[model samples]
Target: MTVALLETAWLVPLYPLLAALLSLAWSPGLISRTGPRPCGYLNLLMVSAAFVHSVVALTALHTNARAGAEALYRPITFGWTWLDTAGLRIGFDGLITEPALVAMTVITGLHVLVQLYSIAYLEMDWGWPRFFGSLSFFEAGLCALVLTDSLFFSYVILELLTFGTYLIVGTWYNQPLVVKGARDAFLTKRIGDLILLAGVIALLPLTGTWNFHGLQGWAADQINNHNTLPPAITLILLALIAGPMGKCAQIPLHLWLDEAMESPLPSTVLRNSVVVVGGAWVLLRLEPLIELSPLVQTVLVIVGGTSALVGSLIALAQIDVKRALSFLVSSWLGLLFVAVGLGGIDVADHLMLVYPLAMALMLMAVGAIVLTNITQDLTQLGGLWSKRPLMGLAFLTGAAGLMALPPFGGFAALRELLELTAASSSPAVLGGVVLITNALISAGLIRVFGLIWAGRPSVFTTRSPEVLWLMALPTFVLMGLMLHLPQLLVINGVFSLSPLPGWGPQALPLLLSTLVGGGLSAVFYLRPHPLAHLPAALGGLQDWLAHDMQTERFYHRTVVWLVVSLARLSAWSDDRLIDGFSGASGSAAMAGARRLSLTTSGRSQLYALTLVLGVVLMAIWLLATPAAAPELVRPFS
Candidate 1:
């Protein structure tokens, strides 16, 4: 029974994809009387099916694992040849692994909650078909991305997710910001996707296979020989990092998530939680190859550290509620990159495992607030603790789950990261950075909590009522999951109890950092404090970080400006040089044809005279150059 279900794991992605396609019928009002809700219900059922399938398969794998270690790591692959030629072959081969199954369960489960949350959140909205379809579209792509064994196919799936983001983000097409946000999201991720494609294509010629296992074996060979990747291949690995860098919302490419906030809150839940990790998923798969290059590893550390530290700082300064979480996503995933860079695959796996749960719960909790209050601006929200204590607790639970506080999901992940960094090449620099990033993250999450549920009631919260059960239910359920996630992980054997004791050498500092960060934030925004809003002198610095450190403006001046300039040049060339040359040649042909037509009198004498003149010119040219005449007549002779 377990084998049968595991063999059919490939059908999981198709369920949602079929739902997305079915949405087309109602989305375009083919059945106008039923409204779009039927389509939505169908999508919900489909995602639920996916969720169940993944859970059962995962459960079966775990149960069967008692047989031996082989049952745990053995891949159940399902795929077919997509392209085949003498020297090149591309396969649609997908494999089910323990990690892939786990990812599917998280992805589909979140989709279920998000879809349920959206029912009430978008109840009045008529774009349900488009919205729900796109949501399923994201789940389908993410599922396939995890299941696929080919790196080339992973790139394809990531591109599909990018497109789905644009579609979902633009669901409210009437809004200018929505359209702009969709465009920015697509274009920014495209930059990474294109570079990743280059790396994917380039890798095949060198390694001769795109299969993850094959690449792993090849990387192991290089590791065995103690050989560094050649400089050119090193560039390929670096290029490969760009895809995840953009997907995970790392710095520079990070602004897309902020812009994508124009999307609905429910979709924001997925983007903030799992969708962005699709790139990180690929990066984790490519860890073996990345390990073969020390330079690439160092680059990962620099980029990840900068994103981790700067993203947390930026999150602290963000007044827009969703933007605050968006930056934190980058910060957390940055730690994932840091882990992979330092060769802490197990630690990275742990970080990736817990991130989506806490993030989803927090977003679901915030989604309730945003839906009721009709605002997402931090300053405009306050004093919801009394009205929405459950949600407040939900938010707090999520915050704890996200931070490195003891007895939660994030503590283990962060402690493991801290432990990994301690023995790294530069322990102080690496470990201090992770510790500080955790502090800043704790501070940022609490700061948002203080602004929303702790301070005196702002105008937005004065009469804010509780949200519908649909929204509240998912938040509460996820909150419960977040609270119990550590035990769940332990039962599932993600990590043993040894690394998860109440106190350890690394756990203490992580706990202290969380305290210091959360304590200061609570004192400032939760109660009266002189420095809560900052002094006037630091106001400029505050504003700078709030605006994402002028990251967008910088891109507009550089990359955007260059792209616009090149586009204008291409347009001008098409009109001026290309079109102008064609126009000139066309006009000359018309003029010469007109002259020749006028001379084409029906008079036989004139025709004969013209023929004689043509012959005389040919003879004159032949006489002028005898050598030319012989060469010209050679073919005929």
Candidate 2:
């Protein structure tokens, strides 16, 4: 393709955004008059077009790369300057072509499949237009996020997606939990976006640019020239990390995601599969800036490692299937954070590449299960394996990928993390921790699966309907993709187990950890004992785990409560203090004028007497003072 044609890659995301706008702007009356199917078909067409454009862009990028065309890798800039201010500038720059092309292709491609799947999943629902419209909007936002090079623009897009999440999660507005969940998700993510904005704003003054490429170059130049950035840089990094932490649902920011499971399965698919990865992607994009400060990197490592450990432990105790998987998502992302903190970009990149596939598979399987059983709680259902063999198989395959088993994408990524941890300072301790977390994750996955598919039919299961092929088809596709992802990675140079020391040593501990974790999970959950008390043994910790450590409550009481109180105080002051003072001052002035009027009753004579008295006093003073008569003497001369 010619350069101009190649640049059409930007249109990939733009098309969906436009379609979303059109769908949203189209009145509900018009949609109702026409029908929801037309709108759905229109959305499908737009997404399909975007997907085709992404594929073409990827093909062009690959061909150009093979031809040694480095210029093809550069970001495709477009549009007017996004923002400009005192000594700082930002623009609408993004990688319309290159690696973003690949990311867009994967994200939109999966969205298309998910949307197709949702047709059947939500067939009985009347909110088709709203659901599909929001899905398109999410695709557009995510695509723009991947393409954008400016941190400021990235933050804006992140906020936009946060809004989209709110809408999608609250699609079922009649459900109180759905409303609460959507609000919590939006509020939590907004907190992170605000922090990230602070970082982006601080960065603009420090570097005078917001473009990722420019910032990376500037940061590298500073390091090369032995320049020291101010302490504000670390604060900026921390602020930026807040966005990722919320997006990736790490630690304290994780509660929103668990609650968000009350949303439809399609939204869950998008959130878990690709939307969360937006945070990790931004983190990777700013890796150079982050590596500038050791303090920042240390914080990342600690938060990531701690989140991974704690999230996985919680995952082991979760009773809600989606909640458990949500914890797994957080835990896995924490591992990615560790990779990034340790300066393992390649490993981080590999993990990013693989995580979405694993997540997509898991979500697809979960979507299928939830569709059939009408519940996401594992404790409410069982014996689905015989009824829906395809879904069960898909779930098992996805679980394998999540467990980091051989020939799965998670395996390659986890291997890299283990190797890196083993070669780090606290190899023994870190390795042990990572190993234990993996084991817990394995147990968590198997526990969910067993509770969903293995035992005798429960009341919920007995009432459950058979899953349609629309859902099963997507699940199977994802399962097949998971099975073949290792080979794909190998071809892409992500699965090369090279014995480089800096890449870390793959010794017995690493191998043994995987084996032990997998084996224990298989024994405990897959092949359960008749007298097993494992499920009953967990109890409240399970509740806490299901609730995602009460992060929402903490944020509500601390951050949300504080903000609301301060706002109320401000409103009170505005209404009662400042306005009241102004009103009181006006009233006092009126009262004083009224008193003066009372004192000046029959005012004409009083005014004349006072004027005569004042004039007489002036005349007496002038006659007594020599200087007072000077003007009269001068006039006579």
Candidate 3:
């Protein structure tokens, strides 16, 4: 029975793909008679099916483990040959195993909940077919990416996701901002994809396979044999890191995610919750290679730490509702990167598993509020607590789930990371950074909540109402999940909860820091006239944080300038050298043709005289040469 259930794992992604195709039936030309609402319903059903099947597969794996089956601990790969030529072979392989199945279950489950939330969130609109279809397409791509064991296919699936993001973000293409946002998002991720391709190409020749497990085995062999990679391979590993940095919205490539806020809120829910995780997911898979390079590892830690610090700072200054939450996504992913850099995969995995539920709930709660107010500006929203208490509670629950609060996944995952960091040199310093970053993350969430919910109601939110049941149900449902995640983690044996007596050493400092940050934000922003404005001396600093520390401007001066300069140089060279040489050669040929044309005549007498002169010249040349042949032989032959 377990074997049969595991065999059905391939249907996970297929369900969503089929749903996407079915959604096309609602396109304008195909089924004009029917309303588009069913399109969303169909997608919800499909995602539900996918999630259920995933649960079954996960249950089978667990059962097999209980039964002591050999395959329980190993990846059960199902694949077919895809390519074979000239000593090269590749396969489309999916791994139905422990963590992969677990990840799939979570991904599909959130997809189902998000789709349900979107049903009412977008009910007044008429873009259901395109919206729901894109959601399913994204789900299928993400599911396939998690399940695929082959690195080569992982790249392919990620590219599909990039396109899916473009399509989904650009769904409102009638708006200019949406178009630009989609274009920027696509290009940003494409840059990382290209660099990752370079790394894959370089590694394939050396490793002879593109499977993640195969790569792991090869890495282990190298380590066991005391082999070291050359500098070039180390650079390749760095190139590989570039992909995740961009995908995960790390610095220098994070502008796209901010711009992508022009998209619908439902898309933001997934992008913030799970889509960005895709990048870190790939990075986690490549951990074996990443562990081999000290320089690359240090870079990861530096980038992650910097993003966490800066992202939290920027989130604090943002008045735009989605931008605040969006920046936090970067901050959270940054911590995950740090965990991976510190060789804490279990911590990273725990963080990823718990991240999507809480974040999605928060975003959905925000979406619920935005639906009524029709604005994402926190400065223009307040006192919603009286009307939309569930949303307020959901947001608070999400904040608790994300911060180092008790009984939530964030507290557990972060405490583990803190414990791990304690063993490093300057443990005090590294641990301080972790505590400070978490404190700031907590502060940022509180700041947003205070600005939007706790103070006097702004004109924009004065008439705010509870979101429809469809939206509220999903928000509360996910809120429940966030609350119980730590319990789930404990039950699954992925993490063990320390009894209350054992909590002081690890959990106290984090809890205290969170309270400090949360209390400060609440005190400052939760009043009718709260210290809403900065002092004159700090105005410049406030502006910098509000504008993402002018990162885009810096890019314009540096990377953009370099690219523009190279393009201008290429155009100038083409015009001056390539075009000039070709033009001169053509002119010379034309002038010669003109001169040759002048020698021709239209008179028969002139033609006869020319022929007679030619024959005379030949006779004179023959006579001048003493060894000339006979006239007939020379002239006729």
Candidate 4:
């Protein structure tokens, strides 16, 4: 009960948020006086401070836990009640816990690296202040998201982050595609958030609390009492899943991430690396509630497995480097979903821990490439190894980690996943799906590397110089970090080889999958082929893959069209029904005013006469109302 304000972890998220607000306030005049460079440096400073604070909090948590501190610490109070009712009360408060601290560490650390990378990646852009400001805002939201305990508050923060995505992606509003991309991202996430809100409302009556711990307790009690049913729990789970689907960019809600590549590379790095994982985080956070329903778990595994397979296929056909990475983001998230569905929270948690690092490395490399060549399309670039060997090396290392090659973090996570599936009922089907998906992801990454570093030098790439060290430094650091993450996992008990039946499986399949995928990529995109044309059998599948399984088109035709039509109908109703009623009332009032005006002209005597007449009429009416009064009295009686 120290109640030490400074020691509390809430400050970690608040610092960057305050900085973002300050930067946004000063943004208009910032460039006019001090310019974008200073703003970029300011952003770096803000994120650095948050990162330091996060580290401090993490250290404190570890120390306390090692000392066997009580499970429930003193709640950090912010203000008065947020809402109060006859039998329930919700408060605006915050608290720090182990999970929150861990998530904060990951988010803040990634932000630091990404912001540092952005310094060189966006150096020449005029909208630097806007870019850094939005990024800081996003960091603030994500940090707050991790710290909050209330599901209601978590959803609020998620919505705020969705808005941040809109602004960050459309920072260059003059560009038409960027504008559309931003709009699409916002609208799609909004739909999912609205659905989640419905779920939240439904749960309030049942649990009588919005706090994560409280809700979990209630759910557990309900399950123990044998009162929970599939239908009711499935409804709640579906509602909760909506937000993650939108945030994670899973199928039916994933096209935004692909289109979002139009944004700056720094933003893309953030989205792919950490922001998109927010959904998976939510799923993990609510694992107990979801586990109460078998139907929910089954649905998660099916969606996740299908998304992984489809996402990998699409990644293979993507021409844009960022789009390919975006697809991979979805695929990895889907894998996390599968882990959660199979009741493998530990495995999912480990995957979440390692994914951001790998994604950050890959995005940093892509950022460097795009900056140097001024393009993201793999079809338009080549021969960068000689110009920027460090970048090529970083890309390869990142690719290795992404494809789950041995001695990397992804390999450890995938092994855990394989083991988890092996113990499950549908082991063969699930295992095969994961294997093939991993293979396709490997091929996708290798294909990108070949297009960039192996083929003939493009005109744009030939003239570009090697990237500056500011960018390369962060990229290489992340690459090195990824290389050592598997060791960290072992040390941290994220995974261990033990007497557990599925543990310590042979590594041959992992190695062979990586080699075969890599070799296939080299053969197709790197090695020279006499005919340069793929077989006709794959033509249809290739086209389907290239189009992202027609997800975007489906959304456009169905969701987008429906939304547009609803908007139009709403507009028409507002104008015709609501406004028209108001308009008619106004017209009637005006007509009455005009009619009265006609009688008011130059008429003091007439006014007196009318007033006298009105008084006489009132008296007559009062006298005549006795009969009506008697009738009213009879009715009441």
- Kindly report which residue stretches of model 3 are placed more than 4 angstroms away from their true locations once superposed: 1-3, 64-71, 500-504, 528-530, 608-637
Candidate ordering by TM-score (highest first):
1, 3, 2, 4
lDDT of 4 by residue, 434-466 (tens): 788888888888888888888778887887677
Q: Against the true structure, what is each candidate's TM-score?
A: 0.94, 0.90, 0.94, 0.87
Q: How far is candidate 4 from the true structure (C-alpha RMSD, Å)?
A: 4.9
User: 1-637, model 1: which lDDT tens digit per residue?
Assistant: 7667876889999999999999999887897999889999999999999999989888887677542244355567678988889978899888877888889999999999989999999999999899999999999999999999999899988988998999999999998988999999888888888888899888988898999999999999887888766678998998999999999988767888888999998999999899988988899999999988888999999989999999999999988999899899999999999999999988888899889989988888888898899999998999888888998898898889889987787888898899999989899999999989999999999999999998789888999888889888888888888878888887877656765633355888889999999898888989747897779999999999988899889999999899999999999999999999999999999999999898777999988998999999999988898473444445664
Local accuracy of candidate 3 as per-residue lDDT tens digits, 302-420: 89878888888899899998999999898888888888888888888877877888889899999998888989888889888888887888999999888988877788888887887
Supply the TM-score for candidate 2.
0.90
lDDT of each: 0.89, 0.79, 0.85, 0.80
Error of 3 at 363 (Å): 0.4
lDDT of 1: 0.89
Model 1 worst lDDT window (10 residues): 65-74
- Give residue 385's error in model 3 in angstroms: 1.1
Q: What would the per-residue lDDT of candidate 2 be over residues 1-637, giving only the tens digit for each residue?
A: 5444566667777788877877864436564667676777788899998888777667666666542264364455665585569754567787664567768988988988888888888888777778888999999999988888878888888888888888899999998888988887887777778888888888877887888888899989989999978878899889988999999988777777877787888878888989999999999999999889988888888889888898887777677777788888888899899989888898898788877877777778777777777787877878777776777777778777766566666666777788888777788776776777777777777777787887778787876666787777777777788787776767766566444212234544554666776666656655456433446666655577556577667777988799999999999999999999999999999999998888776779988998999999999999998773545445554
